[model samples]
Target: MATLIVTLSRLNARRHATAPVAQGSQCRTETIPMPASGDLVANGEEIVELLADADCWVAIGADPDSSLATDGTGTARKLKADVPYTFGIQDGEKVAVEAA
Candidate 1:
C-alpha cells in the first residue's frame, strides 16, 4: 500500500484563547495509507505537509472518485516518493489522497 505522512500546523491560536500565541503554534501529524478514499478536515487556520513513501495522487478539497492512478492523471496533484510538500489551507477544508 502507498503511504502519506500528513502534518498539520495551526497558523494562529483558537478563537477562544485567553492568551496570544504565535502563528504555527500548534500542530498534529498522521500517517495515512492509500488506495482507500477519505477526507481530512482542518479545524483551524493551518498548513499541511505531505510526505509520500511512493509516488501517489492527491486530491485536495475535492472527491477522488475513480482517479488516483500511477500515470498522475485525474487528481489535483501528484506526490513524488520521499519528497516533502507544504501548503496553506483555510479552516474546514478537506484533503484526500490515494495511490497513484
Candidate 2:
C-alpha cells in the first residue's frame, strides 16, 4: 500500500485532547489545520508539479530555517537525514523547468 504524507507550509497550532467517556474507555480527538484554497495536494503528480513550479520550496524535512528558491535568489532547505523516502520516475516524463 502507498502511504501519503501531507504537510502545510504555514504554521498553525494544533490541539489533541483526551477525556474519559465511560467507566474505563476514553475518547481522544485531534484538531488540525486545513489548507487554504488551491493549496491541497492530492497525489504525487500534483506534488511534483507544484514543486516544479514553485519559486519557493519549503519541505517538511528540509534544512532548518533555510529557504530554497527556484530562481537564483534564495537558499533552499535540505531534507533531514533521519527520514527515509523513495522517489519514482517513469518513462515519457517531461522536464518543465529550464536552466537560467
Candidate 3:
C-alpha cells in the first residue's frame, strides 16, 4: 500500500478528510495499493496516467524511503509510504483539487 497525501482548497464528500490546514483547504494523507511498484511512487507520468483527466496536479518525489511528509497535506505535499491508495475523481476531473 502507498500513502498518497492530498491537499485541497475545500472539503468535499468525494474526498476523504483526515485533517485541515490554515488555508481552509482540507488535507488528507491517503494511500494506494500499487503492488507492481512495490512502494509509494508518484511519478508524473504514472500518476497522471493513473489519475487520467483529474484536475489536481500532484508532484510525487522519489524518496524511496522517505517521501511521506509530516502529514503530506498542503498546496504541495509529498505522500508517505505504506498506506492504502485511492484517488478521488468526478466528471473526468480530479474535483478533490489540490490544484484545481
Candidate 4:
C-alpha cells in the first residue's frame, strides 16, 4: 500500500466591481492509505494536490481499480513517488487513489 498526503483547496475567483478578485479557502489535508481497493481522496473539490511515499495512480471522477496495469489504461493518472502533483477538478467530481 502507498500512503499519500492529499490536500484539497477551493479557489474563489470572481469579478468584483469590474476588478478581478481571487480568494482561496483554507486547505483540507489528509493522510490517506492507498489499498488495492483504492481510496477516495476528493469529492467536489476545486483543486487537489497529492504527494505519495510510493508510486501510485489517481483517477479523477472514477475508480483507479487495483493495480498499475489497470490504471491509466482507463481514467487513472500516474504519480511518481515523492513528487507533488496538482490537479484542477470540476465541481462535484470525485478522485480515487490506488497503489501501483
The true-structure Cα RMSD of candidate 4 reads: 4.5
Misplaced by over 4 Å in model 3 are 10-22, 25-30, 35-92, 95-100
Model 1: number of clashes? 2
lDDT of 3 by residue, 1-100 (tens): 2222332232233544664222243332233333212232232211221331222234333322222235655333332333323442222223121322
The CA lDDT of each predicted structure is 0.68, 0.25, 0.29, 0.65
- Over 1-100, each residue of candidate 4 has an lDDT whose tens digit, in order, gives 6688867776555555563222345677777788533233445557777788998877665434434554336766789999999777665555567777
- Which window of 10 residues has the lowest lDDT sum in candidate 2? 20-29
Report, for all candidates in order, the number of backbone clashes: 2, 6, 7, 0
Sort order, TM-score high to low: 1, 4, 3, 2
Error of 2 at 49 (Å): 19
Cα lDDT of model 2 by residue, 1-100, tens digit:
1112322221122434352112112211121121111223222221121222222222321221224466766533333322433232122221111112
Candidate 2 achieves a global lDDT of: 0.25
What lDDT score is found at residue 16 in candidate 3? 48
Evaluate candidate 3 by giving its C-alpha RMSD to the native, one decimal.
Answer: 13.8
Cα error, residue 86 of model 2, in Å, equals 20
